[model samples]
Each structure stands twice: as structure tokens, then as C-alpha cells.
Target chain A: MGYFLRVNILETILIYVVIPAAIFGVAALLTLVPGRAKSRPKYHSGDSWDYPAHWWSGDNPVAVGSIPDASNDVTFGGARGTW
Target chain B: MAHGEVVASTPLAADWQEPASGPLGDAALPLTAAQLELLDDVIFEAERITGLRYSVYLGDLGTDTRNMAEGLVKGLGADGPYTVLLAVSPGQKVVEVVTGAEAAQRVSDRSARLAVLSVVAACADGDISGALVNGVRMLADQAGTLPERTNW
Candidate 1:
């Protein structure tokens, strides 16, 4: 009985802990290895408002170049002034 | 594909896909034409690439960011399955971004801020749709890493 129990425990450790740890170890090692892709994302921007910088405002849909807000650095109303 | 076949209502039966006619196809979310346009131009565009629902609400809320924030949170909760909410109150020049609880737990404030910044930039550039889509895509990327909790 003791021999069987020991074998079961050993198999559990090997199957669960040892295999998972080995896989993680390989992944960690590979992570340290560098890759060739250094370019930023397609639309990556340090500043969020790098595109069109004007929005509509007022009853007549007048254009507003920029509206600063505490929450958002740049805020915009819709072109039709609906937003 | 088979057509003109009278079908019986059975548990084993599957429904056929119908073309969209008016506002949207049946089974699609009930939304206003304007809202649907926004979803199509902004949300749908972002979701196509990232597979996340991004909602935007433009309306007024009296002074107080906390109230606005709370209202936004409630609004997003009511909206169903939405990961993010970008609310704008033109009267107050207040912009509040309320992420769903799941998104909040997963997506960091910095990522949300970055998305907000992109929207602001887009407003500056006169491309509301572009800014919203880009921002939502970023938010979706941030939320994608989280393990989805099952509703059932």
C-alpha cells in the first residue's frame, strides 16, 4: 500500500508540477531571447490627439479647434453639434 | 441553401439568416438610427478588428465628475455586453469614460486614458469616427487579456 501511494504521489508531481514548471521555464527563457519586430502598433501614438483636431459646436454647428477638459486632454463635440 | 420550405417550430430547428432591411436585422440590438450609425462607423469598425463592444453616449450631466462617472457606470450597465463607455457632455465640456466592471478589473486606467486621449486627438482632427474606433480598439486590446466571466 505504501509503495503504491508513493508511486501515485510521484506521478502526480511529475505530471502537474514538473511538466508545468518545465514549460514555464522554457517560456521564460525564450522571453529573454529578443525578436526582430521593433515597430510600434499601426495606430500607436504617445499623444492621443494626433489626428483631426477640430469639432463642431453651438446651435449652428460652428467649429471648435480644441476644448480642454480635466478628464480628457482633448474633447470634441460632433461635427453636427449633436455631441 | 434551401428556400420556400415551410418550417415547423422545433427545438432541433435552426433559423436562417435574413438580410438587414430597415434600422437593423431582427435579433440585432435595438438602437436609434443615429446610435446605430455611430455603432457602425465607430463601434463596429473597432470590434471587427478586436471583437469588443464599445459604446458612446453624448449628452449632458450637471456639474460633478463623480455623479457623471456614476451615471456613466449605470448607463454602461444598462447597455448590456458593452466593455467600455465614452460619454460626452458638450454643455459642460465634460468627458467621462466608464468601463464595465469586467473591463475595469482588466483594463488599467492608463490604457483608458490613452484611449480617451486618442479620442480627444480625433476631435481635434475633425474625425469623430476615426478617433472613437481607434480608442475602442486600444481598449479592446487591453480588455482582451482578461478571462471572461460566464453570465450563466
Candidate 2:
């Protein structure tokens, strides 16, 4: 019957096309979401000096007499180089 | 129609922390006692030769390493002109050599660049302490004391 044929056509479309398309679309969307590919932090494992606190603070490793005063203007000169 | 069955299931596991003996721990301490002694000797000799206060700082500089280094140089007080501060942030792969105004007169920007290059080369070879010592020596040699009877 024509009715039976129509039902069969609709079922075929839903099972073979609609369901597969929906699944594929969901998989594509999941891949595009943020935080799925996180990056690791980079740190160097080498000999380095560890100051108790910021150098300006009182607990500097260098001698107190040798420490330079931050108030002086002469301390400001010099070129910065990056490696 | 056959019923849909759950064939397999995988549990989502939480992130785990690495043990101290792992790669992270192995890379924590970069210098040995011998290397530290070598650096101290080099610094002393460099200061004596250049008549400049040479200080070395090795650590992270947070976000703005230059500003932090400059601040450190400035904090050396009245000895500013005679001070040369070397700040190295291995994590960030940045090295800043700041010379006081007077120090810069002797150790020019070009000289500083050369020292930085030396440090970079050594660091590339996994010689952090050696790089510091070599760079300091180069800077000292470049900024050597003026002759006894020299008039500029």
C-alpha cells in the first residue's frame, strides 16, 4: 500500500540519514569546545639563586653595608638585554 | 528490533600530581655546590677588576623582568653608578644586565650584548652557573678599570 511505502521511506531517512548526521554533528561540536587541549607549564630545572623575599626587603643575602639605597638617581642607568 | 546495549564504559579520571622524584623534581635544582663556589669567585674577581659592584640574581622575574631588575639596580643605594646587576630568569629564558650610569660608560651597551650572548650560549648547553661566571668575566674584562694616569 502507498501508506506502507511512505512509512518505510520516512523510517529509512530517520535511521540512515537523520540519526547519523546528528551524531556526527555532535562529535564535531565537542572537538571545537575550549579547554579540551590544555597546554602544560614550562619550567627550567637549573641552578638559580633564591632570595628570601624581594631584594628591596630587609632580608637581602648581600651585606647591609654593601646594599645600595633605592633613593639614589645614579641607580637608574643601564641597557636591558634578553636571552 | 533488538534493544540498544551499553557494550563498554570508560571512567573519567582526575588529574594526578607527579611525585617529587619525577621530571619536575629532577629539574628543580640547577646548580651544584662547586658551581656556586665558582660563581662567587668569579664575581669577586670581576668586581675587583672593574671597580664595580657586581651582583647576580637568578630566579623568576614574574611578568615584567626589566622593571623588576631595574628596581633591584636602583635599590643598591648610593653605590648605583658603581653597580652592575645581572638578573636571569631561566624559567622565562630572560637575562638582564643593568649597569649604573657610570658603569655603562665603561661597559657599553655593545659589551653588555656580548655578555648576554655568552650567557645564552652557555645556557643553551645546560650550563647555568658556567654561563653566569663567563658572562660576568666578559663584562668585567670589557669594563676594565681606567689606566692610572689617563685623562679623558
Candidate 3:
């Protein structure tokens, strides 16, 4: 009786349930919002590539005009594969 | 941004580059900055370790992928003799690793095939960055250290 009088129902509910729930929701949202952002859609096999074709190298490969044709290719050693 | 790093505003896309034909214009690259950095580091490391130049192409290989790969490497001219080009066409789901005449002596066809297989496995799992980094490293390992070059 004394305890109940000291801590009212409203205060108990607010302290134990309302505040905690609010905190949990806010925390969850904070973590999940970043998580979702980081989970950017990655290319999966069989998935059509919607992005533009990009050529990435340490430096830009020589201009197209300078690129030798396959007929003149001396280095015939390499491997090719498909997934 | 780091410590006092400043982020700049730019009208050009992050991936903007001046290609042989012209510039990439305002086109955005598909990769994240982190992914691009990882790839760049791996290529740099691979070249340093193997004493060979490296390049990567990410795009379509057209109909004749093998020929296209050959042409790209052949086109490297002087660099072609020491270049190791790894061409990946995610759209077509194909990967080709071209080794120069000098590069071939260090990394055999069989070894290059092994690298290709690993890349195929990674591609199956949709790990393009992982495949490139690891596969490039694998090739570097296969190439071993330059015989005559002394690294002090």
C-alpha cells in the first residue's frame, strides 16, 4: 500500500513500460536505418545489370585507335570462364 | 571525411574519368567508394608483389569475349609484355584473365585457369570485389617473386 502510494500507476507504467518501449523503438530505428542503407542492392548471378558498363583500371587503357586487334595479339596465354 | 577531411561538392559523377574515346561525362559508377578502393589497393599490391602491371575491366565483353580480351591486352603495346589484364563482364557473366608473354612464364595457363575458377566461384556468389581482389592476389602468388629483381 505504501509502495503503491509512493509510486503511482501512471509513474510505474511510464517508468517500466512506456519509457523503455520508446527507447527500444528509437534504438532499433537508429540501428536499422543505417543497416538498411548499408545493405545496398548488390549484383547477384542471373540478375540483369541495370547499371552502365564501366572499365576500371589503374589508368585509362590507351585510346581505342591505338588498341591492337586480336590478330596482332602475341600473348596467347590466359584463361576464360563463365559463371 | 576524416579528422579534418573536407568533402567537396561536384557536378561530375564520382566515377567520372577521361576514357580513350572521351570523358565519362556525368555518369556514376556502380561501385561504392570502399569497393573501388579495395580493388585499387589489390591491383596495386598485386603489381608490386609480382613486378607486373595489372588492369581490370568491368563491363560487357560483346559477342566474342575471348577475342575481345585478347585485343585489350594486345593493345597495351609495350605494357602488354608485362601486363596482366583481368576483364570481367558481369552482364554477360564472363571473366577473362590475359597474361603477357613475360607474365605467361611466371603464371602458366593452368595457374591462370585456377585463378579463373576461383573468380567463377566468387561470381556465382555475387562477390565481384572479393573475386577481383582475391583472384588478383592468387595470380600474384602464382607469379611468385621476380627472380632477378632484388627488393631492399
Using all chains and alpha carbons, the TM-scores for the candidates as numbered come to: 0.40, 0.56, 0.71
Q: Provide the DockQ value for model 2.
A: 0.11
Tens digits of per-residue lDDT, candidate 1, A32-57, equal 88563422223222223222222211
Candidate 2 collision pairs: A45-B27, A46-B30, A47-B30, A47-B31, A68-B76, A68-B77, A69-B76, A69-B77
Q: Model 1: what TM-score?
A: 0.40
Poorest 10 consecutive residues by lDDT, candidate 3 chain A:
A59-68
lDDT digits (tens) for residues A1-83 of candidate 3: 78988998889999999999999999988876656335668779988776666655554232122234423548468899999
Name the candidate that leads on lDDT. 3
User: Model 3 over residues B16-133: C-alpha lDDT tens digits?
Assistant: 5557664443225567767877888888777766677787878888899999887787777766767778888888999999987767777899999999999999989998888888
- Candidate 3 residue A26 C-alpha distance from true site, Å: 1.9
1 versus 3: better TM-score goes to: 3
lDDT of 2 by residue, B1-152 (tens): 35884544674565786764533422234554566668878887766555677888777777888888887877776566666777777767788888876677678888898888888877766667777789888888888754541332
* Candidate whose DockQ is highest: 3
How are the candidates ranked when ordered by lDDT, highest leading? 3, 2, 1
Cα RMSD to native, each candidate?
Answer: 19.1, 18.4, 9.5
Winner by DockQ between candidate 3 and candidate 2: 3
Give per-residue lDDT, candidate 1, residue A44.
27
Question: How big is the RMSD of model 1?
Answer: 19.1
Better of 1 and 2 by TM-score: 2
Quote fnat for model 1: 0.00
